[model samples]
Target: MSGSAVRSLVSALLLMVLLAAAGCAGGKKEPETLTVFAAASLTESFGTLGKAFEKSHPGVTVKFNFGGSSTLAQQIVQGAPADVFAAASPATMKQSGAPSPRIFARNRLEIAVPKGNPAHVAALKDLANPAVKVALCAEQVPCGAAAVKALAAGGVTVKPVTQEQDVKAALSKVRLGEVDAALVYRTDVKAAAGAVEGIEFPEADKAINDYPIAAVPKTAHLVLAREFIDLVLSDQGRRVLTDAGFTAV
Candidate 1:
C-alpha cells in the first residue's frame, strides 16, 4: 500500500511541473510596454486613466514621462521612443511632427494668483500693472500664444519678468510667490487647489488652447501605441479628463 501511494504522488508532481512549464510558454503574450510622454498638466488625470488602461489590458505596462508640452514634443522629435505623446496644447504637438494630432480636449487661460489672491487682480487688465510681477508662458507654446491673444483682446500688454517654457512653470512662479500672478489654464489653477486661485478673464474664450494626442510616429510598439491613444479618446478617458477640469473635445 505504501509503495503504490508514493508512486502515484511522484507521478502527480511530475505532471504538475509539465503543466506549469506549458502555461509559461503559452500564457497570453506578456503585457506589452507602452511609454507615453504627456504634458505635465495631464499628470493627475492621465495617472488615473493609465491605471484603468492597465486593468483593461492586463499584462500591459504603461509608463509615463510627464514634462512640459514643448519639451516633451522636442524629446519625441529627437527620438525619445515613446509610444504616445499627449500635449497640453496642439501647438506643442506640431513641434514633434505629429501630423493630424487629434484635439482631445480644450482649456482656457485664467489668472492664477497666490492663495486668496492677495493682489486682488480682479480683471485681465489688472495684469498690466507695473507693480505686479507677472509670469507668462513663452510665445512658442500654445498657452503663450493664447495669452498674447487674450491680452491683445483686452487692449493691454503684459510685461512678465520671465517667460516660462510651459504653463505649469509660469504658474509655479505664482505658486512660489515669486510673481504676483500668472496666466495659466483654468485646469491648472484647479489642479493646484489651495495653492492658487483662478480668476476668469472674459477674453479667455477667444484664445482657448486645444489639447491634442497622437501616437508617436517612431513608436516600435505601434499596436500598443494606438491602443493607448484610443483609450485617451475613450469614454472612460473623457470622464477622467473632464473631472480634472478639461473640456472634452
Candidate 2:
C-alpha cells in the first residue's frame, strides 16, 4: 500500500486499541477491602485466615492492622476506619466500643528466653532475680495485665529493663538478645520460629487470657466483618489457632 494508506491504517489500529483498553478499565470493579484490627499475637494465624477468606470470596481484599489490643482498640474508638476487631482480651474489645464481642480463643503467658537460655532462666520467679534482664509489655496491654496477675500468683516481683507496647514487641527483645527474657504469650513464642524458646510455669494457668472478636459497630463493611469473625470462630479457624499455640475456646 502507499505511505498515506499505511499511516491511516496504523492510526485506526491505535484508536481501536485505546478504546479497548478504556473499556477494560471501565468494566473492572475495584476489590472491596475488609480492614481487621487484631492483636499482634494473632499475626500469623490471622494472616492465614485472611488469605483463606480472600480465596473463598472473590473480588474482596483483607487488610490488617496488628498491634497491641489496647492500642488497636483506641484507634478504632477514635474512628480509624476498621471493619473488625479481634482483641487479646475482652476488656480491650469493650474499650473499642464495638458491641457483641465473642470469645474465640484463649492464651497464656510464658517466659521467652533466647534459644540457649543464657540467663539460665527457667521459671517465673527467675525474672525477679536482679541479675536477669527482663522485657515486659506495658501495663495497659492485655499481655502486661496477665503478666502482673501471673507474677502475683507466683509471688514474684520483676523489674523489667524495657516495657513494650505489645506482646510481639516484648518478644522481640528476647529474640534480639536485648534482654535475658521476656514475658509474652505462648502463641508469641510459638510464632518466633525458633528465634526464641518458651518456658512454661504453673503461674500461667492462673492468668489465662481470653481472646475476643467483634464486628466494629461503626463499620461500613459489617457483612464482611461478621463473615471474618465467623471464620475465626469456625472449626478451621480453631485448627489454625491451635496449631499456633492458642487454646480453642
Candidate 3:
C-alpha cells in the first residue's frame, strides 16, 4: 500500500475505535431511581429525608408519591410500581398487604386553624358551634379515623361542612380559610409553620396514628428500598421525624 494510504487507513481505524467506545458509553444504563409512596402527612419530613438519602447515596434518585395513606396503600396494592411504602396507619398497611412493616413514628391529631385562629376556636367542643365551619378528613383515611376517635373520646359531635380525602386536604381547608378549623396531624400543622396554628386537645391522646414503613415485596429495587427504610429508622431519621413533630417509636 502507498505510505499516504497507510496513514489514512490508520486514522480511519482510530476513528472507528473511538466511535465504538462512545457508543458503548452511551448504551450504559443510568443509576436506578427508587420510588416511595408515603402518607400525605409525611410530605415535608419525607421530602427532607428523600433529599438526605440522595445526598448520602450519590448516584441514586429518590422519588416520592405523597397522598392519603389509604389512597397510597391502595395504589401500591393495585400495582403502582412503588419500591417503598410508608403508611400513617398500620391498618392501611395491612390492607395493602405490605409485609412486616416497622412502626417508625407516631403522630396525634390537633385542631388546625388559620394563623390567627380568627374563629376563636379553642377545644374540640368548639368545633360543634353552629357558626363554625369545620373540615374533617374523609372516613376512609387514617387521619379521619383518628379524628373520629378523638371526637368520641371528648364527647364532641361536630358536623363538618366538608370532608376531605386526606389530612393535607383538611389542612388546606383551614389554610385557605375555607373552614374555621380542621383536625390534622401535629406534624402537618408544624409543616405548615406560620400558615396555620395547631391547638392541642386532651382527647387527642385517645387516638394516635402510628407511621409504618416497609419495602414493597418483589420490587426490583428491594435493596434500595430497605436502605431507605433503614435511613428512616436510624437516629438521624428519628431526629428528622422529631423535628417534624412526630414521636419516635
Number of backbone clashes in candidate 2: 0
Model 3: per-residue Cα lDDT at residue 180 = 95
Candidate 1 lDDT by residue in tens digits, 1-249? 699999999999999999999999998886578898988778888899899889988898899998778888888888887888998777788889976688888888899999877787999999889988899988877678889999999998888899988777888999899998999888889899778988998999789878889888867888888888888899988888899999996
- Candidate 3 to truth, TM: 0.88
**Model 2 segments more than 4 A misplaced:** 1-30
Q: Residues 173-202, candidate 3, lDDT per residue (tens digit)? A: 999999999999999898897899989999
Worst 10 residues of 3 by lDDT: 23-32
RMSD of 2: 6.1
Model 1 weakest 10-residue run by lDDT: 91-100
Pairwise TM-score winner, candidates 1 and 3: 3
Stronger candidate by TM-score (1 vs 2): 2
